[model samples]
Target chain A: METDLGYWIIPLAIIGGAIRVSTPFLFVSLGEALTERSGRINLGLEGTLVFGAMSGYALAHLTGSPWLGVLAAALSGTLFGLVHGVICSLPKVNDIAVGIAMMILGMGLAFYFGKPFVQPVAPDLPAISFGWWSEIPQVRAALEVNVLFLIGAALAVLLWWMLRATRVGLTLRVVGDSTDAARAMGLQPAVIRTCATAVGGAFAGVGGAYLSLYYPGSWNEGISSGQGLMAVALVIFARWNPLACLGAALLFGGAGALGPVLQSVGVSEGYYLFFAAPYVLTLGVLIATSSPTQAMTGAPGELSITK
Target chain B: MPFTSLSRRGFLTGTVAAASASAVPQLGFAGSHSPLTIGFIYVGPKDDFGYNQAHAEGAAAVKAMEGVTVIEEENVAETIDVQKSMESMINFDDAKLLFPTSFGYFDPHVLETAPKHPEVRFQHAAGLWSEGMPTNVGSYFGYIGMGQYLNGITAGHATTTKRIGFVAAKPIPQVLLNINSFLLGARQVDPEITCQVIFTGEWSLAVKEAEATNALADAGCDVITCHVDGPKVVMETAAGRDCFVCGYHANQSPLAPEKYLTGAEWNWAGVYTNMVQTVLDGGTIDNFVRGGLADGFIKMSPLGPAVSDAARAQFEATKAQIMAGEFSAIKGPLKDNTGNAIAAEGEGFAEDDIALESMDYLVEGVIGSTS
Candidate 1:
């Protein structure tokens, strides 16, 4: 009876949580959308994500500026991505195998380097107060959005536009649609795909930066919680669309927040089940939105793996 | 040092990486081939600053000991992964002693591996080893609940609002018992105190932990503690919210020294050193072992600057009583979260007593349910 008002607070908590949690997802999925749009599959972004997290957290702890940490994370992510891209560009290299190796390398490097950062606290990213109108404390806290969330939202729209309306976007779309066509058009498929992969890695790095600089921001070996892998699924579910990636990220964030939100309201009954609610719902959405015939509706024609 | 067997020759295939890593006092036995080989399996990373870290510290102590070589394989889950890790350590390394330090690995993995390698001593933490278990399979755990009790005393005095928050991994007996002990200790200082708990159904998920800490903070809980594998995320989030934090397993003071009040810590150095020494002495380990502050297995971290001197003094006094076996957190006249009585008349329990293992219900001051 005491927690009856939990129902009302749960939505607000989720709204706040979604924006907070979705920042990483938004960045990762957007990066992934760009990479996938270039006819390349970099499954190793998980590794890139974690490396970004470790480097970002460690650098933030050192520089005392969250933005520098973000910059360093993006750079490290770019390096890892470049390696994966070059290796995949080899005559006989399998993108999947190289992706897996890159993931392992990224995690191992992060683990080895992140050992020092396990105990230290880093500087926090600044937040914007959107809840000034609300007198309720919960609403105020929930509405205190991190600046990265705003940047991610704007980037998603910018990416969606750039991918359709820009020459570089046209070149990327052409490469992703057909290697033969890209080569025929003097686009140099490998070069464009490599650049796209590098750009994608930078985006993932920023996502990791958001995680360590803001909400639940700390660098630990287990910090990512498969968020990197989940972002890949999110991109697929979003049909590789940047705007849809934003929506999908928020959805996933809300789902991840479901258990804690319910617990806040005192529904201890089936509490264990509540924690599983997010994953179950995410899977359901992924399954429902992805269909047998409609699976590749907006998919690039030249993407080797998808074909 | 006694040689358990000559067949253990060339057992370990790799060099001890922790030899340079550990600075704690050790025996450092000479003759590489003659050294006693030991292995450890962790459910999570050794740097977790929590349960796994505590055990790793113990293992590190063992590594420093004379005639002992330590091999550690981390992130071994409770599933078949543990079995592979155990088998590899036993077969490839010929580890004479094995400490699989996760609760879930006990019945299925340790139980399956122990009887098969009777010559190899198997020591498990948070496991129930009895007649049903192999003699070589020993169980050892610390009375961390007592430390929690003491920390609760500190929390009670420190809290402006007696609303304490608990972020737990699961409602398993180990976690439930610790929560009860923490509440019991908090209520010892203030009878009106209440603890709201959230279980994330995971051993370690940092984001969920942060969200839970935020939720509890919004719900007006100013003091927070947790029983997850690692409490770093909880401590970070709690301190970020300007709430007082009670750490678990290891001291997270470095994470938030200003906000940290105190923590319930596990000092496995005693248990690990004793086990290794016992084997070297050609003696048998107690099949079931439980230790507390009296034995240096469970310890309370130094009180942070945030705690008042009076609170520290009171907690110290209570801790002394616990160490002296004069105070029992679980005794007669105890009741569950519901109206039903949990302890009947004349019920008695000690700090490290095995009788406290069946803790399934929340105490009166607890604000959450068991289900």
Candidate 2:
């Protein structure tokens, strides 16, 4: 069986892993993209993601429903987003500074409250078996896609469409592109940006739910290996587009899985080096896509990173 | 801004007071009637269910002793923060004996701090205390690989797939020893059994650990175990996937009661209590200390419900042999996975042999590379 299966296992495992690992990335980047589309950067999504994971897991363990856990995670994320937005909206408050503070606060809250939930087992989110016809157990396991991944994918498409062809999208763009124009249109830029950031936080919360409810499927202080923070980079690589964010997340997931997939195939030489695949991929993609000649292709006009 | 300035002045005054207070403990406190104060610092939370928890349990045992006061600082980093913690313990808490339990606390933190406080005995865990180091500094480690071997015996008997998985943090010698021993112990049960090992390249990465556990389960490894800082993620993930698990570092049966077979645990409670008692009796601990199952330094967790009667019988018998020094996990007639000779026929290294400490190769039937 080892000899016969050796040829295709690597690619098969990578594909399966890409689907499983990308859920959190997809959710966070989508949320980040939405926030950045309104000219705000929420770096605290890392803390938000972690806090959501803890709250979701704790709630799920107590309530006996993974779906409710997911809801609680999203709500907690929204609360975090609202807090970040409200604080950033205050006069003389720097969004980036507020974001950094929020990140620390979110993680601190999660770790403090998350101590008791570490040992208890919570109900896991169910997955749809797409490879039921396959007799190979690995194939079946790999094809078991979680429901959240599908929701994230659909959300990406819906978001992309909403950003392109809707009145609310146009208003957000106006508020993000030019504060004067937004006020000229009788719109409150703070109110619009705050709402957008809150929705983005909701997306990030669902992403956190993905971590503690599915995939790795547990809660701990180390559950996230900077994936929450990585979403910001991922959003930039995706050119602030929701659809592109989906593809970029899958790419990151595939790179992250490279080390373990190689080890499973008996390629243990330079094993530690393979673990650097995701970071290398990130650097390589950023360097290749970035230009020194002009503004980023789709950066929001008032975005702090671009300005 | 006003509050910040006030607090900064208060901190400076406190530091001066603490510096002066530190001298009291060093002045004839050893032979005096005062309680011996011992300080323990952990690199992570006290209840991490892994490496730090093992030490914390030991500290708890020492805390319960008569005429002994334990001062513990959890979540202390391995950087300058550890040095600061050591200083705080000595200067502010008046601790005469300090146990900086993290491995990274040894090199610069403990070494640099030990000299400044000659009266304080700084003992580190899992560090090699060579000559030329401060006389006040000592090191202690356990032959926990023996416990892993027993875990392997339980896992081997429980596994129906004839395959087992090991999730390791790194390819260090100490970790390698445990992996090899686990494989060898399983091979004793069934020669055809092959152990697949996956190195996550980190001590406490929950995401990678979970992914590795899932990959192992997907590859048909019915029994899974791991050597990481915290086995909570691996144990829970494996149990969720219906895979039997053997734990490492601490008892994890409570996490997966039904699926848990057995576990390799560090009996630091006994080691800590003994060291504390010796100090209280006006004695000094050895500069370098090491012990295995026979010396009560490491132990195996009680066999879980999943362990069959036959498996438990073999496990107990082999454990008895190990304790009596009649059995060696790294015995002769062994080869590396690369087919190179590790030990020829009728040759073996005892558990405490310095040769075993430098182990760099995985044994045959273990599917992994050290590099």
What is the CAPRI rating of model 2's predicted complex?
A: acceptable
As a TM-score, model 2 comes out at 0.93
Q: What TM-score, over all chains together, does every model reach?
A: 0.91, 0.93
Candidate 1 docking classification: medium
List, residue by residue over B220-297, the lDDT tens digit for candidate 1.
788899999989889988887789999899999888889899999999997889888988998989998988889888
In terms of DockQ, which candidate is strongest? 1
Candidate 2, which segments miss by more than 4 Å at Cα? A1-4, B1-34
lDDT (Cα, 0-100) at A49 in candidate 1: 88
TM-score of chain A of 2: 0.97
lDDT of each: 0.84, 0.88
Which tens-of-lDDT digit does each residue in A1-307 have in candidate 1?
0122456778877897898798988998999899989988888888898999989999999988888999999999999888888888888788888888988999999999988988777998899999899667677778889988999999999999998899888888999988888889987888788888898999898888887778778887788989999898888888889999999999889877878877766777887787776678877886776668665677887666678
TM-score, chain B, each candidate: 0.90, 0.90
